[model samples]
Target: MTWNPSDFNNTSGLHISPKDMWIPELIIHNAVGDTYELRTSNFMKLAISSNGFINWNTGGNTETSCKVDISRYPFDTQTCHILIGKSSSLDYELMMIPAAAKINTFLYDENENGEWELLDTSVGYHAINEQMTFLKCTLILKRRPLFYILNILLPVILLSLMNVLSFKLSINCGERMSYSVALFLTFIVLLNIVADEMPKVSKTISFLQLYINTQLAIGMFITTISVFLVHSTNSKTNDDVTGAVHAVYKFCKLCSKKQQVRPESPKGDDQHEDKYIKSGQCEKLEMEHVQQTPGSANAETNQSPSIVDAVNVIDDTLFWSFLMLFVLITIVFLLLCLF
Candidate 1:
């Protein structure tokens, strides 16, 4: 019911109290705390028109339950909802209507602040049952990534690069093992820092967390290899090198990508002609037991470098290979996650 505009000095509307009139009672259904009440303002000023239209602006800070999806982490977007209305009353007695927002043609208002941009703010309706209907406000927010990139992302990337270069340290100088161990510890610390900032949920892990984990694994691998390399480099690897040591020597050669082996048969010796020697390309590790006594002729036959020397020979290749691996994976993961 309404009166003529000429009845009250032709005023379009009047500022009045929301408590003075009967309005829909809206409460937060998915509230997290005891603050489910949406009507926090008592002395609310509303614009009451002569035609009985009421623009009652009502809002307050609401702590509501929202599903957290941190798959993109610092570059992530989040959607949260505010469910408003009490389903205690029958649908005919109470119904929710999305109010027209004052600022724009859209149905809901939007305001963005620091760190998070408000991508969308929309009001919608949902029914609990045949007897009840409620209002739902959806909030879509996207994180501002620049701060996180500088503080966390760039540092982690630099650390990864330094981790690969630890292989270039001299094993005998006692720096490689320590350097690798330090990098491993640093990765662990950085991981902890990141974990603290994120919500504890196993549903969907972020790409940033996965990248850090991969780097951690690499750090651990480098540290273990450094330990073995240092120990072997310091120890005397004579003709009595173990099978495990020889296998490691072969692995080092593989890492260096040199000295590919091919089987070749000797034509002169008929007995040995049918036999193919596969270990010829790599130095003949089959060291003959040379007599150390003076005037022994066979002593000069054991001139080939030991497996330890073989490892040292290809250390540079290993360093470069690991560095390249770090760069390639970093670029791939960043590109995939971003695009």
Candidate 2:
């Protein structure tokens, strides 16, 4: 509201105090689409300063809803606007000076908000419509990621690493599948928590959600691998052992025999066996027939696949695969956050 307090002054060169006169207080226009819920009453306190200067204070806080963009999440910045103006133009005419020197922003308690840092503010005139002009204060906020790093990200990364390490657990332990499933459930809970914190809009996905989804995929992969390994490692009869397992066992046996033989033996028919042994494939025992045949240990065909060996092979393979995948994921996410 705008008014000249001197209008009530006497023509006899007498002074008039604003304390004895009425000063209009500006109120927010209701027709604006974006609005805030005031935390205090609408009544304002009028102050009559020296020289008949008048000042009105409408001190309050607003709990308004803002459009949230969580694509960067822990490293994101948000801008919120607060509009103020006359509620109606019935009794008074309002005017404003568009000068940056007239505006002042001073927060008494800046440290009250721990998660968000006040970056800066922007003030300007916003035309609500042809009939209304509003003063808008735009507040820019940045999220402080230190707390989230210590509390949320650390635990999630450790959980993923633990899941990778679970591949080392023996199939005979009977806890491999259970451990993987437990980690998978934990990932689900974390993902849900992240989703709940965000607004349900069709914007870009958050970085935290991307990481969580990748971890969930890794967990499911480990669980499936565990189930397959346990099933393959638990076969009681050698008849059920597939050709793949037989091939692996024979290859391993050949490598062991090649390591045992120090001197170079004859290279007649053993030449073919030498190629397979060197290439880590099945090697024919030619001159080495005098030595103990790997198949003779069990009195069956060329070396049967041992359950313990098969389990170990699967565990070793999964451990390396999961580790490499985790490293790749970490690099990709770090680059995303940095850029």
Model 2 ranges off by over 4 Å: 1-43, 48-53, 88-93, 98-103, 128-132, 199-202, 243-305
**Cα lDDT, model 1, residue 209:** 92
In order, candidate lDDTs are: 0.74, 0.68
Candidate 2 lDDT tens digits, 107-220: 546688898888887778888677667677778889988877786777788899999999788778987788889999999988887777667867677887899899999899
lDDT of 1 by residue, 202-255 (tens): 999888999999999989988887777666666764544445555666576565
- Candidate 1 has a TM-score of 0.77
Give me the candidate number with maximum TM-score.
Answer: 1
RMSD of 2: 7.7
Global local distance difference test of model 2: 0.68
